[model samples]
Target chain A: MEFNRRQVLKLAGLGLTATATPGLLAACSNGKPAAGDGSVKFEGWDYEATLVQQNLDKFTQASNIKVNYTPITSAQYVQKVVAEFTGGGGPDALYVYDDSLAAWVEGEYLQPIDGLPGVDEVYSSIFPGNAEAMTYQGKRYGLPYYTDSNCLIYNAEILSKAGFSKPPASLEELESQAAKIKSMGLLEHPIGLPAQLSDTWWAWVWGLVFASGGDLFDNQQAPIMNTTDTVTKDVLTWLQNAANKSKVLDPASLQLLPVPVDNAMKANRYAFTIGARYALRDYNDASKSKAAGKMKMALVPSLDGKVHGTISNTRMYGLAKDTEVKDDAFKLLTYLGGLDANKQPNTAKFWFQERGLGFAYKAMAKDADVLASLKKFADPAIYAHLAEIARPRNVLGVAWYTEFETEMHKVVQGVLSNQVQPSAAVASLAQSAETLKKKYS
Target chain B: MSVLTERRPLGDTAKAWALNAPAITVITLLVAYPIGYSFYVSLQRNNLKRPKAKRFIGLDNYKALFSDDAFLSALKVSAVFVVVVLGLTVVLALILALVLNERFRGRGLLLSLALLPWAMPGVVNGLMWRTIFDAKTGALNGLMLQLGLIDSYQAWLTSSTGAFLFTALAQVWNTLPFSVIILLAGLSTIPSELYDAATVDRAGAFRRFTQVTVPWLLHPLLIVLILETMNAFRAFDTIYVLTGGGPGDATTTIALLDVQTVLTFTDFGLGSAYAWVITAITLIISVGYIGLLYRKGNFEV
Candidate 1:
């Protein structure tokens, strides 16, 4: 049958409505209301996801609250989570990086746990540096997932072969020892540190600077590392010389991330490198590392050999500001980052015992089980010593820290690549920080 | 009666519009709204991290971009990247298209294999290149070692020039197949009569290629140039995976910088300004290509 134009138009209109109606209805429908059934949604960067699920299962069994856990890729975790939060849907509780805490708090994506149950105990138990890292503008935002300080990890066999029984105690000694190791044909560029242009790159720089007793910013958030006599300058100069002039630093470090640097250490390609204390676990895991059983952690070398310190970092479990199941979410947060109802640091113990993850709890340092587990992959004494001295970078407290970190990565990269002198690069970074601070303020 | 052939009353016109309403609405919501919203966002100091401080800042974000050293450096990097990738892709694609257009054994298989890189995702392509160019265990170094080309493994991605070249080459590998297909289609459409006439007029092979082939393929080449330019400008996944705009700002394209600003820094206003700048650049380049290749409503040399 031949249809008239008007009839065809009417038929098309009906078909179009028919096609779009379901989608429109779905868009309007709130598929499931959150927080009504004692359930919480948790997210974190992917790292031993099976273990996370097992712990979540334990939490669910103990608390009688169901949890939906999702693991995002670590590299894109912040971007993906921020996008979800911006779009008005995100997990109830999620992992928060210490460096990103200030930005997330400023963005109002996270809620303070200042008045939450067991929060005070959680704060009092963990290391003060980690607690400070989680706090922004006088309010605590989360509890620690794990905390670690950057330590100088060395291949003991390689260093012994190069006629060194102990790790270098100063930056000058590190360079000279690295040069001897290189000259002996044990390894080319015997020092390895990740200088890749990433947010984490600043951590390595800050760790070295802190080890040398340099302050990047004052308490008032003003730049302080611009002067030539500062340890920041000394650290930057050493890094530049190691990468370019002395050539004891592997050029590949400029392209490597933390894991790759660890892998390089495992392969015994370097006599020394700076990595997180926890990475010592993987570095000494015989099954995973060829250099296992020979790797040892040393204090991060400094300029004067008098001050010994490193940059500490923490990853915490934070509550989303808009979480519907606030109580359940807090329970999950406490379970993962603090103590459970039994007052036992079950999650922290599990992570430390299983993965050799550093614990934020000060008590964990003295726990027999934690010490025994630490001895399996790392030296408990060195780990304890580094923990005692490690301090989180002061810049992390500022809202402009992320932007400053990005600029810092560029400046550090510029120094490593020999595009600019360390002095000029440090000055440039200070300028960048001041500009960002002013703009953000 | 056929809908196109039949005359319609004004009431029927209303019916036509009513029928199109759903589509129009969908387009408005999905396409137009974001563009309009982004323009408004670009004009404000809408840093997500500083929500309380956000306010209407007019063209301040755009003005700041002119002085942003990172953004300016990214713009330069993007310019070099687009030029290098486009030149390599168009030239190599034309050569491949010309070769594949000729009758040969396994030509079908060759064409099929040629499309494999294009079929691979950008991230995968990047990973593949990264493995090949990796400093410690890369196959390139291993091959060079075995062949006695170099005594030691080299850090290929460490140098700025090497990183930029390898990244561009990876992009070219991913994009060349599409251009080849386009040029091949254009080649098929080129009437053999033009080639025959050129040959009959005593034009040599090179002369025939210049006189007949080049002129005939201008439209397809124009499409390739415009598309590859935009693709190169907006390339993120491959570069992000490969080098992450690194070593120093060696490979940070405007697109990478834009994402870093928006997501990493959480500065929506500045990021939107970056997005608009990229869009404007892409539009200008596209229009320039069109005008150069097409004139008086027809393809021209």
Candidate 2:
């Protein structure tokens, strides 16, 4: 006996009604204000209120313009902006780095601000050679707001105790000093390195690589790392052997902030380690450590026993592609990136370091207060040292950085763990680099 | 109209198909479309900066991903992460659930408190753990020293193994509450009469637990296990916020890798491919678990 169609319809209706209804899902709760009329929605990370309020107040007082700020942390900033872009509500202004700049550029989430007043001037001020990299397809995507260069932060007390009056002037001298500190039994770590599997490890290692006169990639977008590149091999080998032979590096050195090498240095557990200049302020701000006044900085060793080089990175500002107020946004960029902005007495007095930002404009860099901070705290010699030898990170386009960074860490880890030789690791890295160049480029 | 028996009845096949229509429609729109689109993307050389250069090259992404050490390491770490966190969470949750199920004066408060870890936002929870694990000024090391448990402060999240272990601990702590709540609800459904009958039969506590409680709770246990396993595999925000998958790629997971690919690298094709790979694995595991449970009558209802 065949069933009738009406019976089937009734059965289906009963089954549909029997299932439990799904729960009402709420939207993600962390919502900032949307891009509003007469106000630009800006997203940044780790910008404290007092400093930001002061800077904003001054900018507003000067231009009568207001910005609605939505702050996130450095790590979350990229994710948030990407999400916003993906969702079609990206911020009108963003803070981005050179490493991840390609990501936004590739996504077409940014607008080139070439015609904006003073962009070209702002671009020219940032250590001349670095400017061309910020331009993509003959258009300026971002203006350099501030730049960073890594150098050696040493414990003056430890150095004096070990009979060294100043930081090492060469890689051989640096290693010899590290060994001397180890021999004195005054320190547990001679050098603090970035071994931690985070964003800064590549940055930390790249400095050493550049100082040794090794290139991460060549101009043709091909992998330059091969077994024959002795400089690259030497750099990786030194990091591994330093961690082992010197016995000054803590087993947990990888997990530390580049600055906290100063903490160990302060405690006399380490004599020297690589750190960013901005971190010098962090060291000064630390109330518990004893090395505040006793710390000194120097550049990483270069080839020829000449002035050591450093790795320089710039954080730039850009107008959002979809911003409603192109003129106002450019006005803000001009104020932030131009000489007029840095020369504002209030910008120096109120927001200078309180905002935990460094000076980018030539005028600001030479300001009496800002210059004092750089001269007294940040090593003057190292800045010059980096200027002479510093090279930008390998331009692998956007998709290639993650792979390159991963392979670099593995190579370092392999050497440290004794699982692979440094030369072989370079060979492996070359293979990874080759794969990336072929697939992505 | 004269005879109601003349009306036709739809067959079981038609009825079953009709019942599934809404779900099928929703799944196709929400899940299938994106998955299919991403598969198309994975075969292309798509860069966000150069949209004009997008070109289809089949299987290149998959080939590239295997040779990429970071992607491989991320997958391995993710697997280890899921297994270790799940093992820790399930055992701790069961014990807590059993303890809370007993009659007590502050039972209601205890039950809510047990579930509090699950309620905290992921980023906040991660930050709190990060501070506790900080080398210079973490509460954990400070307290440990005060208590004389260890002489020096250990960098809990800095070394390869240390970061891996502690990140797993944090994940377990964050997820255990959910497991406890689910198991507790399952415990509620067990009849008191069955236990009373067991007592009359002179059955010991262990005997009663094994015979009655275990069998009765099996259904909900299966649900909890499957859901928690999937949740654990997809864990991102907590680890990303806490460790950023570092002292170097030590804590990187497939989800975090997907993030780096999409946001950091702007290799959407590769990122989407990785996402699809994870989703496919999850689907396979869920189906396999359900099949096993059904065959064993663990979820007979």
Candidate 3:
């Protein structure tokens, strides 16, 4: 059909308008929202994405507030988040790790959050140390959500078959048992310890250090890396001894920890591993495990003939200093962190799976399902193990821990590989620690 | 009437200015400002982990980069990667293009199929290759062993040499397709009579190719080579996804170092300094490539 001049002009104008609208809208909305309802745009990696969303939904349903979640990869999110903050256009709330909390808080990028409503409840319910992980400059900047600590996981059947009904009570005894299991040719390593940069590495080291009465740092906060009192030396020596000296564990433990764990429990490669509680959860989730019900949790072996001292790491939530709606954000935070938050079975399960974060909530920790699942897959003594030694250390700055550990990893790996002697490795670690003290300071 | 005509000329100038104004403004705001800010950041001693510790320490970051072991390794990796990837891509693409030029039964299908790898996203390609190279259950190891080509599964990512080899292969796969397509377009432009004349002179296929096809395709090949080289130099996603620059820093590139310095370590000043160094290196290579190409008479006709 032929169109008139007016119709043609009208269609042309419509096309022009459509093409121009987005640009115009972007120009208009550059500094403000179009709807006039002030909205804060938060961006970060989605460690507990859907769970955070579900909690946000709950908060919204309870109160008329909305949150827009922008998820990026962990490393990318930090870069972009810093860019945003530097540009003065960052998200009001973000997901951050402990390593980042100190830096951000020290930078004044985070608001002091201890005074926020329901945060106190979070502080008490989640355990003090978990909250302390998010604290910097003597103020809490994040609310604790879930925490994790390590335990010794052993195959009960394997232990029983080796003529032991219970897991080892000391590091020496643990080694003896490991030797027995190793003699049976059932495993490449009796207690699978991955020397990789995971919670296990820190846990294993920290347990030995704390139990042996070795302080990681001196009173002046100078890094005491090579002291006889420091467990760093003992832990490294023990691992080397186990793998290289005794041949109780495989040499590849220098590369990975979970590999040994997976091989032992799931693939029937070993009888035991000193791993995180999440490993138990992982065991139950894997359908290929032939020794699921046969496994049990125990306190990680103590160095000084006491229960192993554990260090717990928690995933916490903090209100962004730049958040447009701090009150509402706190409500969201509170709702997610509330005692009853995990009461909803689905929400509790969501918390467990999304972050692999253990609960700070005693009730949730002792929940029948949680306990049953832990008991079903974990060695028998793990909960008690966590209770005894899974305390948080507020002394080491989060950022410092990573730097210290990274340097220590080189030393540990060197010792394990026989590239360096224990004393030489420790001496170098001391030097590195001194360097980090300057760098971090 | 003359005044009116003059007014119209002025109006045309005004119209031209208006058309270009927004673009100029956008370039200034988006590109110029960020570059300026990044430069400013590069000169400072800033830490994202400790934002309160932002201090201006000019050239310290630059000085530090010269001493960083990771940065040096990354620089070496990037240099090797770019040169090797560019060389491999150009040669492989030329062969593929030459093969595609001749009329075959499934030429159209083959050409389209060849483009599929290029069409896939970088992440997908990285992940696909990662899966293929998986030590435990990878198809590559399984197939190789089944075919009696190897006795045991190779840990392609764990060993330094193996990781480097696999990473380079992944990069070549990602980049070679673009080279092929560009070279093929150049090949299509070459007169068939030139090839016919070469053949009539009793020229072998290789001689005919080198004498006739290459000179004609030189310009396109240079463009392909330079662009792919730059891309390979900045290859982050594939390396990030596949090896994570790991199995002990075997695959870490300059870009990954810049990212880790900035984000993971929260050392913004150092990161920006590393970034600036990368940009400088890239610019130098780009300029060098252009100068060499021009000198070699690739741009003459």
Candidate number achieving the greatest lDDT relative to the actual structure: 1
Q: Candidate 3: deviation at residue A375, Å? A: 4.3
Q: Which candidate wins on DockQ?
A: 1
> Which lDDT values do the candidates have, in the order given?
0.87, 0.71, 0.69
Say what the interface RMSD of candidate 2 is: 3.8
Please tell me which model should have the higher DockQ, number 1 or number 3. Answer: 1
**Candidate 3 chain A, poorest ten consecutive residues by summed lDDT:** A27-36
The TM-scores of all predictions, comma-separated, are 0.93, 0.78, 0.79
lDDT of 3 by residue, B64-174 (tens): 777766689789988887777777888888889988988989999988887778887878987899779865558999999999999976656655566678888888888
Task: Write candidate 3's Cα lDDT for A406-431 as tens digits.
Answer: 55654565566565677787788778
* Candidate 1, superposed: residue stretches over 4 Å from native: A1-33, A199-201, A340-342, B1-23, B296-301
lDDT accuracy of residue A143 in candidate 2: 64
Q: After superposition, how far is residue B69 of candidate 1 from its true place, in Å?
A: 1.7
TM-score order of candidates, best first?
A: 1, 3, 2
State fnat for each of the candidate structures.
0.66, 0.45, 0.23
Worst 10 residues of 2 chain B by lDDT: B292-301
Model 3 chain B weakest lDDT span, ten residues long = B1-10
lDDT tens digits, residues B1-301, model 2?
5856665788999988888988998898688987799899988876564566778979887887777667788889998988899889888988998999899899999988888898988778888898888766799999999999999887677566887898888888888898898888888888899999999999999999988888777777778778887887888988987777764567889998887777666667888888878887888888887786645644332
Please compute and give the TM-score of the first chain of candidate 1 against the native first chain: 0.93
